[model samples]
Target: MKKIILLLTATLLSTGVFAQVKTPQPSPTSKIEQVIGLTDVTVSYSRPSMRERTVFGSLVPFGKLWRTGANENTKITFSDDVKINGSDLKKGTYAIFTKPTKENWEVIFYSDVNNWGTPQKWDDAKVALKTTAKVGTLPMKVETFTIMFSDFKMDSAKLNFIWESTEAMLDIEVPSKKIAEESIQKTLAGPTANDYYQAAVFYKETGKIDMAKEYIDKAVTMRKEPAFWYHRQQSLIYAEMGNKEKAIEAAKKSLELAEKAGNADYVKMNKDSLKEWGS
Candidate 1:
């Protein structure tokens, strides 16, 4: 009976130690993902409300680096290289820090992002890019902090920061036109060697012998370097087209290349096919 009471007391003590009471966070976390032109942009931060307190030149202060959000570091990521205020920023995530004056705000993208709120020792070497944005006042009061994308276009967009009545905007540019033109040029340049080879394989599987023969011949001619698999496919296509002489020639080439490449499977396959074809 004593042992049983002792076990129950221990169990109750353990349960008490592990018990937790859930409560709402003072500042909630937020994540925003947006596609500006061909580039992907993401922002993550915590939003702290004004709650009838003075925001600028008071709580946040002036001429000092602000974390730009509550709790963890405010981070922004870009999928492609971008330009901010005519300055180049490479593709990656960066911690956003800002220094606010009465008229203008200096926005910074820091290379280091792992921090609770701000780094213990500020390092100027870690600053990737810095640009100044003019501050504007909103007509009405804003209760919570917000970061948003506005004025979106095919190649550019505006990143806006709003808290209380203060507003600042950052102009961001992406290489949408350059990326699009490159893609269009590649498409207009016609099929590559691998493209022809794949088409030949598809046609051969679907019982289109004439088309397979044409595509395989183009693949073999267009290839910059000799490939054993291309020759093997060419041999198969020629054999299917009833060209025994060309088939034997291609099989011999394939066998030679396969041996040089040290591919035992292709070597054995070419030898078996050559014997069956009476070569």
Candidate 2:
């Protein structure tokens, strides 16, 4: 009896391990990433097949909020702020929900993205942006639900949702021109004061006293307000150039500014340099 019980327990354990089955999900998850202009957009959702059944009106009822996908909430992420149907949306991840109708679909970007399907408790305040997209009849039937970007442009694109023979499109606009212009302006504006200071320090370290003096002078003149570190670097450059008067003058200014800014390190450094230069 004991041997028979042990054999039965071993059989059951082996069966439990071997009986686990893996099969294709009825609705498979899909993810797509796109770059429109300077922004990166990503969509993650589950795809459900029609399986010869009617979609849209019947399977997915009209005048109701949909998860926009099968199992989990459909999520869309943006690398930069974007405009959808003339409404501004911040840069972040959002769950996409929708209400379908024969003429149009109300697409919603929801702030909360942790729900399994539609939220049990819908909060209007959680709705980031809601826009209506006109429904169009597709020439060919789409067996599986699809979400994709179309009509690509440098600053704009269309987010298309197609299922069966119905299609809906949302226009997305990115700040490509604004970003590009800002970048161009910054590049064309010439180096900053810190750039000159760093160049001066590099030149000084490389034993190029002339270039160091030129850069340090430019750095000092560019500042609208006095910076102790900049003046300190200037003093060092002048001292290296064998100009005791200018070095002492710059060290004195650095000492004053450092004292005002409550920087003990710079104050001590400037005082030591001043004493060394016979100030």
Please name the candidate that would achieve the greatest TM-score relative to the true structure: 1
Best by lDDT: 2
Clashes of each: 0, 0
lDDT of 2 at 204: 97
Q: What's the lDDT for all of these models?
A: 0.95, 0.96
Off by over 4 Å in 1: 1-20, 197-220, 223-279
* Clash total of candidate 1: 0
Candidate 2 local lDDT, 62-166, one digit each (tens):
999999989999999999999999899999999999999999999999999999999999999999999999799999999999999999999999999999999
Q: In candidate 1, residue 129 scores what lDDT?
A: 99
RMSD of each: 4.5, 5.5
Q: Backbone clash tally for model 2?
A: 0
